[model samples]
Target: MSAFLSARRLALLATRCPRRTLSTTPRWSADPWPLPHTAQHLSNTQTPSDIPPPTPIPRPGESEETLRARLVYQSRKRGTLESDLLLSTFARDHLGKMDETELKEYDKLLDEPDWDIYYWATEGRSPPERWAKSSVLEKLTIHAKNEGKVVRRMPPL
Candidate 1:
């Protein structure tokens, strides 16, 4: 059946990229501007570069939101989800704190489901206040841990 062949092809594609592909996320650098801004402003510029800039992908559907929001409703407010608690503990307990790039990445995740969250979580930075209530932060932590990016931290003496 066509469905069976489609499923097989999907499996093959998943295997091709062992890690979640954040192809647009190069190592954060001071040199180049962030792609979201560039992509939005591209049409106004006089000289478009030879290589097209990355475009900001829109959320897939009504389901769009943070992993936390996807999993649980904040209005229920039975305190933070267990997953969020765990993520906070890890960042507060160790990871030596997040740098500017990591913080920006975390903030961006709250505003949007940009792939930047994966890098921020794996890099061990906490999302800032504007995004503190988001499910995207939860999803970022979950994915980073599930992908084997976790590290145990010793309590500060």
Candidate 2:
């Protein structure tokens, strides 16, 4: 009977203690994946903010002012602040000089995933072949190299 009680207690302790240990040591400390430096972990330590504001979209046949506003909003609201600042500054600086076709291309580039854009911009990783020759992306490369705060030369894979 003492042995049975001891085994039961051991099983209960095993279940509780492992979870406490694991929770204290985050797995990312060992994993090499490039985890985004976002505000996700802060929610546990700080009060959560409200849902992000909606992105403005240009209406069909909208005025240039409307399109400019839409693009500015999109540029400023990327998944990470690094991408946000890079894109928004580039857009606000150059969009005024772009013709309608150039504006369309720039708008299409904004639809790309933030990780891909961030990697391409800050690390000089070439974008997919489809957009490799895009003038807009070329301009973005220049903008990122000149203005980005977190630029790094990722070691050759």
Candidate 3:
């Protein structure tokens, strides 16, 4: 009888069961799984039972970081929604303010090798908009030539 019982116990132990197969009074066999990643972490290390329910997400007004995000020019502060979106999209979120043509050019320039267009788009400063700046069309012209393709001229912006 003892040998048969030992064999049964070994059979259960040999199988790869995910849950605890052996349970004892006042103590568990397998340890509890670690806390889930989505579980809210409290600043305190209180017992599991003492842990409070997940915290509620603070409302917009209750957030400090959201309130501090703004666009500034010199000493002036620009806090409108459009300005914020522009600054964020182009660089941080301020690129949305450029005129339709500027935005179209800005979109194309986003793929350029040099970072100047992105820098200017996000910084709210267009490097003088001079011929020396090498517009997106000019850069595309150079790229097409490198790839042995001909690019037709785009009407001047």
Candidate 4:
């Protein structure tokens, strides 16, 4: 009698529960939900690229303290990881001691592409004529060499 009751209960539960079917569609469909008209237009028009914008020239009468802070931030936030570590560490070690002229040169250096700067710093590629004579670049290359010291991480601000 107990076995019969158990069978009947199983039948009832099976009938009451709905069967689930696997979806034929992919989990990530190519079809995205509709966007607003303006957004759709912008999305279609804009293509992503790696180029960074030109760094702005220093404002007239900008204070040295403010310039140093800005350079530190830019150095720390360079888009590529290699450049970020190298530049941030270099800035921490050098920026405070740099005068207004040197700071301006460093700011211009920041405007160059990350790979170019990284290669130049590491001595993997020769810098262009403009940078070849720059004292700032010389200092950066010296810092990047790391010599006997290993630079495993970025220095704190």
Residue ranges of candidate 2 with Cα displaced over 4 Å: 1-59, 147-157
Q: What C-alpha lDDT values do all the predictions have?
A: 0.43, 0.69, 0.35, 0.80
Instruction: Give the range of the ten consecutive residues with the poorest summed lDDT in model 4.
Output: 33-42
Provide the TM-score for each candidate, comma-separated: 0.22, 0.58, 0.19, 0.63
At residue 42, what lDDT does model 2 achieve?
Answer: 22
TM-score winner between candidates 1 and 3: 1
Judging by lDDT, tell me the better candidate of 2 and 3.
2
In terms of TM-score, the best-performing candidate is 4
Writing each residue's lDDT as its tens digit, candidate 3 over 1-157 gives: 9999999988887786556566556575433543312123111212343444334333344232322232122102223332233323233323334344544443444332232332343332233333236454344333323354333332111
Candidate scoring better on lDDT of 1 and 2: 2
- Candidate 1 lDDT (Cα, whole model)? 0.43
Candidate 4 structure quality by residue, lDDT tens digits, 31-137: 36433234543354242344444667648888888889989999999886778998998998898899888999999999887777877787766777778999999
Tell me the spans in candidate 4 whose CA falls farther than 4 Å from its real position: 1-55
Better candidate by TM-score, 2 or 3: 2
Report the number of the highest-lDDT candidate. 4
Give per-residue CA lDDT, model 2, range 32-82, as digits (tens): 533453334222223223433224355578777777777878888887766
